[model samples]
Target: MKDVVDRIRESPKLPNPYHIGEICVLLPKDNPDLRGKAGYWGVVSHVGDYSCTVQTWDGDYTVKIEHLKLLELLDEDCQFMQQLCVRLRQLHQVASRDSSVDWLLQGLGKQAKPYLSSLQAKLLAAVEREYKLVWKQPKQN
Candidate 1:
């Protein structure tokens, strides 16, 4: 969708895993398949010219550049979108409280209405909880 594309374009450019901290894992393309899936989320431990090593929550693995699709990166974007969706929903609820504000909420409600679908909600919640963001303080910092 154009909206999705616009959102992706607006997203901050994620730095390569190499610059991240120790826990970052460069997920392997062979042992695991992370394409369009929400399960694989990790940090990059090391990066060579052609491949990168990642230290995942379960273990460490090396991945080649070609196989390193943007699945997890897209997942990260979804995570952010989830947060925004939540905020928008909260705003809608607040707007509903006052009759005058209801008009404004009507427009926002239409845009966010799709996310409220039961199936999509369930899947989003599951992915959110599964690949939940885990912030790790840098050892040196």
Candidate 2:
């Protein structure tokens, strides 16, 4: 199996602004069809030469080498990174204050209401469930 170094080398020569565990603001490469719109901003949970994993504010996405182009490190991006850190801290605080499941349910209920479509709602629920599972404390009864 390939190791981390191998994965890192596989990517293009351009330096990536993201580091493992650092939050990043991601945007889709320029595309006419997309009207040059910015894509979702997310946290860089893992970065390898061959692949990167971004935990977006809305969901998680596994990005391959070919799909990536490192965005510029900017002040706005820094602000988002700070926000992500604060959000993570808040999540931990809430989870510790009450059962994680309860905290997630309450949080999700408040956060997910804007997606009106049934399919979108289901998908969001599934994503939230996975996130909760990934972060849950094993000691909780």
Candidate 3:
């Protein structure tokens, strides 16, 4: 079993082979700053030769491409993810103002799912309401 695992680990794999705008999950094992943010979803904002800048709900992170696992979501789903990103950002801002909400934020940060269920969405909305965080529509340019 150990030999098999070693062989699998030794297999050739692509590194930093991702494009901008792609959705990916962070592998936080190697980064102390991202310790509790493992499995969080982020969108690639910039792609460099060895690393990519990913925009998450909390903030932007520049990590090696190899540390990300691309999430193949549908076009519609991708759009939903973008919207969710905005919502999460708003919620995070509100949560930051009150340290009591840290648990909620921590739980959200650990979400590994590519999408949230209806109940989960409703629960998040309820939390936002509790915090008086209103969702504002984007202004037309």
Candidate 4:
């Protein structure tokens, strides 16, 4: 009787590449298309096989982990940013009160539509200022 042996080959697994909303750097040493984009940072919007899609200042791109570096923000700054986000969310809840406003939105309650709009604009501006991106509003009829 001949002896037979079976061997299973298992490939090493990589950890999670990145989380959504994470800011990562691009190292374009090998890709000519990203040659000058090495220094810029982008937000990781989606992750794929050995690659991730990021939204940058100029555009979005799918890059590999080898060419992506995670940005480590200071603890204090990170905490502050988190708090700012929470505050902005609270500010957004202000919109629910809009339904009870006067016909022209200049009513006795809801702080008036104009004031509420101003508050939202300010909150959105703060978020944009910290994140270096603008919140584009949908077109109105």
**Per-prediction TM-score:** 0.29, 0.35, 0.71, 0.47
Off by over 4 Å in 3: 1-16, 95-100, 136-141
Q: What is the lDDT of candidate 2?
A: 0.48
Sorting all predicted structures by TM-score, with the top scorer first, yields 3, 4, 2, 1
1-141: candidate 2 lDDT, tens digit per residue: 578889887866875545765544444554332232244445567777556786644345666544444444565554445354334444444444345544443443223122225764464345446556333322523
lDDT of 1 by residue, 1-141 (tens): 999999998988655544333222223445455433223334455777666664433334566655444333344444443343343344433422445334433333233222355654454344334444232322542
Q: What are the lDDT figures for the candidates, one per model? A: 0.42, 0.48, 0.75, 0.54
Clashes of 3: 0
Q: Name the top lDDT candidate.
A: 3
- Candidate 3, residue 99: the lDDT equals 66
Against the true structure, candidate 4 reaches a TM-score of: 0.47
Model 4, 6-109: lDDT tens per residue?
Answer: 22224456766687766667789798867767665656779886888866544578887888887766544433333333333343345443432222122211
Clash-forming residue pairs, model 1: 24-43, 24-44, 25-43, 25-44, 25-54, 25-55, 26-54
CA RMSD, predictions in order: 18.1, 13.2, 6.7, 15.8
Model 4 residue 103 lDDT score? 20
Q: Quantify how close model 2 is to the true structure by its C-alpha RMSD in Å.
A: 13.2
What 10-residue stretch in candidate 4 is worst by lDDT?
Answer: 105-114
Candidates 1 and 2 compared: the better one by lDDT is 2
Off by over 4 Å in 1: 1-38, 70-141
Residue ranges of candidate 4 with Cα displaced over 4 Å: 1-9, 74-141
